[model samples]
Target: MAGIGFELRKYLNDDSFTGTLKAYGFAGLISAGPWVLSIVGVMLIGIVALTQPVVGEADGSGVRQFTTSVTWLMGASLVLTGLLQLVFTRFVADRLYEMQDTIVNANLFGAMALTTAVSAAIGLILALTLFSQSFAYEFLMLANFVTLGNIWIVVIFVAGLKRFKLILYAFALGYGATIVLSILLLPFGLSGLLAGLLIGHALLLFLMVGVVLPEYPVTLTVRFDFLQRRLIFPSLIAIGFFYNLGIWIDKILFWLNPGTSEAMIGPLRTSLIYDLPIFLAYLSIIPGMAVFLLRIETDFAEAYDGFFEAVRGNATLQEIELLGNHMVSAVREGLFQIVRVQGATILILYLLGPTIIGWLGISEQYVHLYYINLVGVGAQVLMLAVLNVLFYLDKLRDALLLTSTMLLSNASLTWLTLQLGPQYYGYGFGLSMTLTAFLGIILLSREMDNIEFKTFMRSRPAQEVAA
Candidate 1:
């Protein structure tokens, strides 16, 4: 991500206002494109399903079912892929650091094949047992889940490389095809919608594979050495799982709670009070994400590399200290930039809340919820920046603890809010993230202060003796 940020920053080298805006604008789009596209695609499907009677009433039953399936598929696939994402990223990073490119592709294939098989088995069982829908619906749902899972695995690899443009193009094509196909097959009802999504996702997976294939030798023999490596950090697996869980835990609580949710399809449920506002609020974070990538990846990353290079080159202790301080300052500046940009963005969206909600034809009640959730997601972006720095600092324990707290707090607080009623709905998410960000800031500051001591302590015994 930092590499991509640096690459994009090159476009803004002229330093003109227009150039800066264009660079950041493009970065924001690419950074948030997949999420924004998914939301738009789902909303479009809902709109079309409402207008055309697709095996359900105009009251949005069919739309609800289609959207519900999509939501579930996304949640499930993300959870399934979460563990693999961090673990595989670590493996790939290590392999690349060692310049062993051939194994990277082979292991990726192995991981994909493993994830696909697991997703298919689980999806098939769930579709068969839980759904009781027609064979077409079941098959399409299964296919969609499997394809989405594979797409996520491919994304892990693609994101590790500098293929942001290819990724953007793939999602654009895939979602565009989905919209067109869903309309063409509208008469076929929910099954048609699912089919469209499945086909689109499959195309996306194929394109991602195409981009990644050129990076390594083609090998039929699959290996799981990365997964099997004895030295792999167990905390990484936990952090991956907990972080993804934290993000979705509140939604899950809402969906399952009787007071806030209703069944949309099969056993799946949607929270009327929580979903739309949160979704809309998330869209507001594009600016923050763009700034995050730009600052952290470009300025902070350069400082970080310089510090390490200085250390490796046997620079004077004072020089190393100065470089370290520079890196810390860069991180602080980057974080501040994120907050400033995102705060302004939140304010703008809050001011425009009514106009935007009115244009969407949603009830005015949603505006307040939208305002609250905007702050929540903004805080989430801040937390993400903190976590990125923690990772760079090799503070995996801190990252794990932060994510764990977020997961527990989000789940418990969201449940409490549900009991407290509608007025408190979005507060749970917002408050939890706000508290987590506060803690992260403090921890990050302290960690940066003692970074040199920590580095020395973590070095080899021989190096310690020499020192």
Candidate 2:
């Protein structure tokens, strides 16, 4: 509780209001809420699937049936969610590009409606297709529970733009309540946990609707012109496809190869043990945003302006040199801060993560993966942060290219690791991402130096003549 509170405060008190808001809202919706909630659902599915015993060996037939049902449920849910995301992304991206604040709000509301409808439909479908006679009641209840949370998560993110703090507060409360309720009801077993989730989401949705409807003044005018001009639809579609693929690839692997007695195939168990490492990996991002905020508004802003001016008209050598110094200084400062915070977080996770996992009723199989992955994740955060700073310094195109390369590298590495089997899976991803980021930073640094030197040479002659 104290840790969560501290995180909330850190975000709320950040100097960059706009950036903080965006980060807070995004983190809450995508990272904090949906990510965790989806994991819970998937974990449930995995556990239930594994519980099916082999007929000759145990209750094999029942296990097979349960696995089949969970598999179907996951597939249906994912497909529905993906479709909704595509539609919503198109809607929002188009509105945002045109600076159509009114239409954006309307689109957001429309998105909420679409999401609710989609989630509910998916829930119903799951109940019908996935729930068996024996477990039908339990499965239906679980479907409802996960669906309700899904709906609220999407709705809140869309409506959460300016009211960043509100979004954070809502998510913290919603998930916190869910966690508490889940723990409290665990004595009653899985059914109780499922019911608790349904209730928690229902309450959150009610609160979110009440808060957002009153706070926002939305208008019903939408124009897709801005998006059309940019081909944003295709761009977003591609990005979304890749993004989802990146996140779920590992999970897919695990589900396919969960080992003896486990139906899943991946190295990382979808079980409670994996939670610590995965959660810690996620937590590493908190400080990355902080470092980014500090660097951009201060050092990068100055460097960018100077770089732009030099580009528009050749800058003097002295001017370029000054810019280089400023950039270097900024990078150093930002990295120091990032390393400091990241180290602290890693230490805390190292010491307390096991205890937390136990408290959450997670099994012990995932501890090694969780801790190691968290470290790799932290290193990746640092690398990514540096890349982001470079981007802010008027290197958007290069940044985009670097990002593309990183994804490509990650894909190739992940495939190789999978071929080699579970031992190398996450390590490959972590290493590749970090390596790519470091290479990018090195290239950017050289470019910065060259630009600075050129600027100084251009300015030196003018100064000499003046003297």
Which model scores highest in lDDT?
1
lDDT of 2: 0.52
Worst 10 residues of 1 by lDDT: 458-467
Query: Candidate 1 — which residues are off by over 4 angstroms?
Result: 1-7, 229-231, 460-467
TM-score of 2: 0.59
The whole-model lDDT of each prediction reads 0.84, 0.52
TM-score of 1: 0.94
- lDDT tens digits by residue: candidate 2, 44-137: 4334434433211254343233333344344434544553454354455444545554565555555555555666665666556744433634
Q: What's the TM-score of each model vs. the native?
A: 0.94, 0.59
What's every prediction's RMSD, in angstroms? 2.8, 9.8
Q: Model 2: runs farther than 4 Å from truth?
A: 1-99, 116-162, 179-189, 205-216, 219-233, 260-276, 280-332, 343-368, 383-426, 439-467
Please report the candidate that would top TM-score against the real structure: 1
